[model samples]
Target: MERLNGYKHLILGNHDRGHSLAWWLNVGFDEVSEHPIIYKNFFFLSHEPMYMNKHMPYVNVHGHIHGQKYAGVNYFNVCVEHWDYTPLTFEQIRDAVVPSEEQA
Candidate 1:
C-alpha cells in the first residue's frame, strides 16, 4: 500500500476484522471506514455488494465476491481478479455507469 500514491481509504470488510482500527490507520490509510460510504452522491462503495435493483439510481461498487458477479447490473465487481489486479480510476468507474452524453 505504501508503494501506491495518492490518498488511500480503507473500508473494513468481513475478512478484515483481525486488526484494530488504530492498526489500519497507523499503516498509512488516509481514512478508515467501518461502513459503506457514498461517493459523488450516487456510488455506494463497500467491501460487500449491497442490495441494488434496476429501479434504484445508485450503483454499488464492491469487491467481496471476487470474480463472481452479484445479481444486479448496478452491482459492479471491483475485485482484483476482475480488474486484472489493476486499480480503477474514479473517472473510469464513473464513465462506465454514466454515458458521456448523460454526463453533460
Candidate 2:
C-alpha cells in the first residue's frame, strides 16, 4: 500500500486478520481496530456492513461488500468501486447524508 499523508486508521476485515496488528502498524496504519467504531456519535465505521434500520440514528460507512450496496438509507459503502476508485473526505460524506442545517 502507498503511504498516505494523514492519520491512517484501519478497521480489520476478514482478510486483514492474516497478519498481526503490529504488522499493520509497521505498514503505516496509525491506529488499528478489531471491531466497528462509532465516530461523532453518528457514523459507524467498519469493515463489514452492520445491520441498520430506517429509524436508526447512525449511518454505517463500510466496504466489505465491494461493488454491491447494503440496502438501507443509513448505509454508505466506501468501497472504491462506488467512488471511481477515489476516497472521499468526511465532509463530503457528511454533506451527502446529513443536511447542513442538521449538521452540528
Candidate 3:
C-alpha cells in the first residue's frame, strides 16, 4: 500500500476474497464497465481474462492466473509471485507475448 501511495487505485469485481479488506482500508473500486481506459492505448483491467472478450477497442490486462500466456488477441497477465506489483511497459509485455520470428 505504501508503494502505491499518491497513485490512484481501482479494483475489479472479480478480485479475490481479501480485496474487501483493502477496500475498507480506503482503496478504490470501479465496477468493470464497457467503457475502456484510453491512456497511451485502450487498456482494460480485470481479475479474469474471460471477461475481457466481452468488450472491444481495449487491450485487456488481467491477473487471476499465476502463469502467463498470450494468444495474439488481447490479453496480458501481469501477476507476479510475492511481488505486489509488476512494472512492465506495453512493449515489454508485447515482446513476451509475441513469439520470435525464428521460433515461428
Candidate 4:
C-alpha cells in the first residue's frame, strides 16, 4: 500500500487465498465487489475459471489451470508454472484466442 504512490485499485471477491490477502492489504481500491468486475476492459482474476457465462465480451483472466490453455473463448489462464506468474496482455490474449476476421 505504501509502495504505490499514485495508483487506484479495485478488488473482487472469490474463494481464493491470494485475493483474500490482497483485499486485506491494498488500500487504494476505489471499489470492492463480490461480483465480477466490468471496466472498459475486464480482467477476470480468479483462482480458476468456473461457469462464467455472464462475463462475456470481457476476457477472463484466471490462474488455476496449469500450463497455457487457450480456449477459443476469451479466457486467459495465469496459473503458476514452476513458481512464476506468466504475465499476459489483452492484445496477446485477443491474438491467441480470438480468431482472425476470416476465421470469425
Across 1-104, the per-residue lDDT of candidate 2 in tens digits comes to 56456778999999999999999999989899999999988899999899888877899999998758766778888988888988788889888888788977
Worst 10 residues of 1 by lDDT: 66-75
Tell me the lDDT of model 1 at 17: 80
Candidate 4, run of 10 with poorest lDDT: 8-17
lDDT of 3 by residue, 1-104 (tens): 55543444343434445455455346443232333344445566665565445356566776667755544367777776423565666667556545678226
lDDT value, residue 16 of candidate 1: 81
**How are the candidates ranked when ordered by lDDT, highest leading?**
2, 1, 4, 3
Question: What digit string (tens of lDDT, one per residue) describes model 1 on residues 9-40?
Answer: 99999988889889999999999999999987
Better of 1 and 2 by TM-score: 1
Which 10 residues in a row give candidate 3 its minimum summed lDDT?
A: 27-36
Greater-lDDT candidate between 1 and 4:
1
Please name the candidate that would achieve the greatest lDDT relative to the true structure. 2
Q: Which segments of model 2 are wrong by more than 4 Å?
A: none
The TM-score of predicted model 1 comes to: 0.90
* lDDT, model 4, position 39: 50
Model 4, span 1-104: residue lDDT tens: 55544443433434433565456545555445555554546555544675558446666766556666646376767555723644455566567656688335
**Residue 32's C-alpha lDDT in candidate 2?**
95
Residue clash pairs of candidate 4: none
Supply candidate 3's per-residue lDDT for 25: 48
The clash count of every prediction, one per candidate, is: 0, 0, 0, 0
